[model samples]
Target: MPQSETLRAQAAPPRLRWWTELPLILLVYACYSAGRLLARDDVTTAVDHGLAILRIEKSLHLNAEHPLNRLFTQEAWLGVPADFWYASLHYLITPALLVWLFRSRAVRYRAARTWLMTSTFLGLIGFTLLPTCPPRLLDAGHGFVDTMAQYSAYGWWGGEASAPRGMGNLTNQYAAMPSLHVGWALWCGVMLWRFGGTRLAKTAGVVYPLVTTIVVMGTANHYFLDAAAGAAVMGVGLLLTPLMLRAADRVRGSFALRSGRSPEASPVRSPQVSKGPRASIVSGGCQTSAGERFPRQRESALPTGAGPDASPADTGDGAPAAAR
Candidate 1:
């Protein structure tokens, strides 16, 4: 290959197309959703677990969802908007932020995506293990009214919390302990705050997660502890990210090495025998059959009369040069 072409290839590593990771991302989410459904225990068992959580909340005076639920249901306008926000933002905002990061912040996008996916799977584990219920689905005497159902006239949700009209059956209603709505919102908030260029953008980041927390509570879809657990799961994901990446890199390196290839290795040149052991000076560099590349120094650094015939090791003192 031409020397110029080789140099350009070596200058920078190739970047993967942004869309390449999309399939993997989608597959992980699909698995998480399916896993949550399969993770479901008996309804009776789940209800008992839900009651246990509510009882614990009462003991600690954290059973604030009752008042929030009443306020939302008492005001139709407020309840409708809250339902919309709860249903739409959880799905829309998170994906929009992900697309934005992929398109605009390529460098940080991988870490962010990994962290988000990891946290989601972690939440799935919680759903699988606990199968706790949302506040709205609790018994009627608990005063935790299903605001989504009450405001179903204002929106399309059925009795389920923010679920679609007839599609409530498809959702994992018991996966309510670790609120991914709050978790994903918090993740978006953190990314925007850290990477956003403007003050207004940063402020929006802070407001979004807080508003989401209130929405989840007011909608009676999650307890305060659920939101906290979501944030905690995300924190664990962040901490595990570096270790995960490092382990992944090591496995990749091992595969490449075992296959007798280095991803970053330079192009191999077939050696060409030259008469009388010659060297070539290329643009911006030197090339030798011995496989050495010396970067070109300033033109003035060479002796005043040096030319194509100049000795490889010729100093101004003019001694016999060493053979490279």
Candidate 2:
């Protein structure tokens, strides 16, 4: 194989674990759907807990003035407009990649999409369970904007800020405990590491999370803890992705074994038969090994008037028709 093709085969992601993901994704969505509707007690407490953390940070000298406070305070890029990247562009990418995978060789995209989807599902759980309000919502007591609520056209409000169009357009307006932004960036980094051969490309891929972390904090959009949680979630997703791929490979192997026997593993099965030096010949057709002449070849250009048991004129003693 060519060098690039060889490298691609080596770097390709694992096979699809369709059976596992189909049900697992359904279960996850179901649980979250329940949380969205049924867990009012847990939901209320999570929001309270998030508020308590903000208070604790204030008393322990970790308040808005602390360098870590940048996660909830600074707005250095205030001069920029709010329309540059207000929408959740990343969300759009996941669905598009999913459709692309469905139409093409599914192996690579399956693992990646599962990881992204599962992680996003988990993030929704965190949102309802911890209901974090970003720093932009801080007001003056160390003010913070609900980054999830604010939709900046282009400005970087810092803690992975975005300009959401409206609350109705988003899934959860408060799911900021773990920034899926950072998680997807980590995912992209791994993908680049696995498939990108150039050192510079890999370097760029790896450095993005660090920059993203800064952008998120500087804009008061996420607390340091939120970004940490996002990274933790991606780590779990990465580990889960490979386990699924291996299981699918095992299933595919079993299926291929049952399809058809290998060519070399069985005797050829032709039906024509005869006796004598030119016994395998036919009058105007191809003969099978058991003397049953297959009639299809009667019209093809034959050398001359040959018949059943007629040996090739070129051979004095035809040797089993030279093994077609």
The most accurate candidate by TM-score is: 1
lDDT (10s digit) by residue, model 2, range 1-324 = 333443444323333465765676567656654544333334455556557767776676654323533333244243132123223434453344455554563646677766766676676667666676555554456544443334343343322335323433224435667876677667766665655568985895687667666555544556667788899988877777677666666665566567753212223334333333333345433443432333332322233455454434324332233334
Output the lDDT of residue 99, model 2.
52
Count of clashing residue pairs in every prediction:
0, 35
Question: What TM-score, over all chains together, does every model reach?
Answer: 0.77, 0.52
lDDT of each: 0.77, 0.53
Model 1 stretches astray by more than 4 angstroms: 1-14, 255-261, 264-324
Residue 95 in model 1: shift from native, Å? 0.9
Q: How displaced is residue 135 in candidate 2, in Å?
A: 2.4
lDDT of 1 by residue, 1-324 (tens): 565766565412225475777787789879877876864555777788778877788898886677788889898778889889998988898889889998999878878888998889999889888887787877788788777887788777787656678887778888887989999999999988998989988998999999998888888889888999999999999998887766756776678789997755455564453444344444434454322334442122343554555555543343423445
